[model samples]
Target: MNPEKAFKYDVLINAEDLCDREFEQQDFLKRAKAKKRTIVFAPRRYGKTSLIKNVVGNSFFNLSRNHLVLFFDLMDVQSMESIAKRLHHGITQALSRRFPVKTLLKNATDYLKGFSLQMDMDPVTGQPSLSMNVKGREVENEMTHLMAAIKTLSQKYPTLIILDEFHDITFVPEAEALFRGVLQELGESAVFILGSKRHLLTLMFQDARAPLFQYGDEIHLNPIALEDWLDYFRERMTPNKIIIGEEELKWILETLCDVPNAICEFGAWLLDNIPSGMTLSVGVIKQSLDLMVENKQSYAYMLQGYTEKELDLMTVIAKNKFTLEPHAESFLKLIRVSKSTVGKIVKKFMDRGLIEYELEKGYRLSDPLMGHYLATR
Candidate 1:
């Protein structure tokens, strides 16, 4: 076993720490400053959270010190009421950070009259905490008030509200209709930043029959270039007196499909678990791969929720590196299921956010690590 080192590479990095997402960051800032409604998307664990946190939350475009940025993560939201509460809380949190407590309370109460706002002392910390409440029909009314408040703030501060995992909004019944109606009424004063799973976001924003169709400009966040990641890896490794050759860097990128988070995580493992002042070699790489296989057990556990047929279908997917047409004779013989049954299985996996399909790429596993693990296993 290699002796552990103290140095750690964070999987979640700030924009300054981020490697080569300049174009995506600039596009986002440009659309936001112009008050254009925009939707940004990428596959899960592709650093959507990191980008928004560092770029928007850090206010890269706030040159005048006049824009208020409110960020909300809808990943945990399951209902309209929860959305209202989160929005109300997110706005309050942003205000509390920028202004005095007394001023925050007064402004919140005045603008968000639909929600009762007050300041209370924390029992344990003896710190002042803002409390807000909206019940029953007031939830809807307050959601509208919240948008209006944001619009009002935008006139002075040019507010930008980023709702991460915005596609989750579709899970709540009639939530899309309510949001569309409210945003249309609210106008362009406040810019909306929506980040979500690419496929679901496309269905929500690009599908003609969807309520929010054509409502926002769409941008895709691509994986970082291998050259940029190579520099990042070498920079991180050299400071620890550890060296990684070009071939090793290329192997890591290819194995991880150039996804930023996975690469950083494995790199963190190499930095922290390997002995300090020791150069990384192919043996160390093998050890890392072994550790990765151990992590794949978690993916295996996830597979427990699936049926045997589904498991076999996943095997077929992994073996092929892409899903073959269900009706194709070779595919049908391999899965030993009817074409309609295979179609249903594929749809179910897609709905569960486990698969993606493209004409050029065919069907792909959403988690590249999972696909790699399953393929080798």
Candidate 2:
């Protein structure tokens, strides 16, 4: 091995085989098979995207005469027309991987017909240029051609449409209702797997007046256990190729709060440093941690709806080892609010989905994954 170096490429850590999350995977797969449109809810960086990626790779469902999985991410998309265009493009990408678009979209209407409901992107500065205008107004009729296309395609291939950041679709105003309506009409013919961060989805469903209300099976993605992670790392480490000491491993896990993205960041950092056959150390880890923290401080400012007192309380919870629940003394002092007052604040936050609580105890941030930020600044 080379005598000395600053490590190699960067640490690259990931589940050995996509870590198929049991409850989530089984729930959605079953729903999809029953032709039930489903929504997967999870906060950012909690592995929603990763889970979808894993499902696609698993082939647990058949593509021939059963299910054809089509995945799309709306992270960069922004408008109504953009929705139709993006779905057209996403489905086309999935189908055309083997079939040609020219062959499938034989008619002008056929071009716009494949998209039942679309997640819009701003016409300008979109990730990919999509032409989605078909015929009719914003009403259900407007989606006829696109709906027809998806129905036709499913007859032959049985599409499993996986939409990422589906909650964002609501920002397009009228898009959510139309999409949900389409789901109702599709029935057992096709399946849609939609995922979003939080509140928006619940709000849509809670409001019985909305078309999307109680539309599909709601599945929550969960964090992987520490024990599973430890076992995984042990299997992947080979003394001659890469070495990860127990202390360094523990430090990495503790600092990141088991966040998938943070774990990935540590892995990437680790990969960049590992020499052909050398072990990692504390210094390498500290440097990488600083880099990640430095890059992430901006989000702290972005999460600015809270008051100073609230922020301080959040900090306390962030640093504390106590449970996230109600009537907890430590949490009360951390927020510096009286019992009832803290209850009000907690209720407000719960309504906004900024935090969550156990029915019997106290509250914590709505998303546990955001706990990663506490590790930083």
Q: Pick the candidate with the highest TM-score.
A: 1
TM-score (C-alpha) between model 1 and the true structure:
0.85
Model 2 per-residue lDDT at 77: 51
Kindly list the per-residue Cα lDDT of model 1 for residues 27-77, writing each as its tens digit: 777766777776776766777777775675566435555557777777747
Residue ranges of candidate 2 with Cα displaced over 4 Å: 1-17, 20-34, 57-62, 65-67, 75-78, 105-144, 190-192, 206-213, 235-251, 273-292, 295-317, 320-376
TM-score of 2: 0.65
Candidate 1's displacement at residue 339, Å, is 2.9
Clashes of each: 0, 29
For model 2, what is the C-alpha lDDT against the true structure?
Answer: 0.57
- lDDT string for model 2 (119-229, tens) is 344367553322444456663454556556665655555666677777667668777766676666676453445444355667776568866677776766666776666
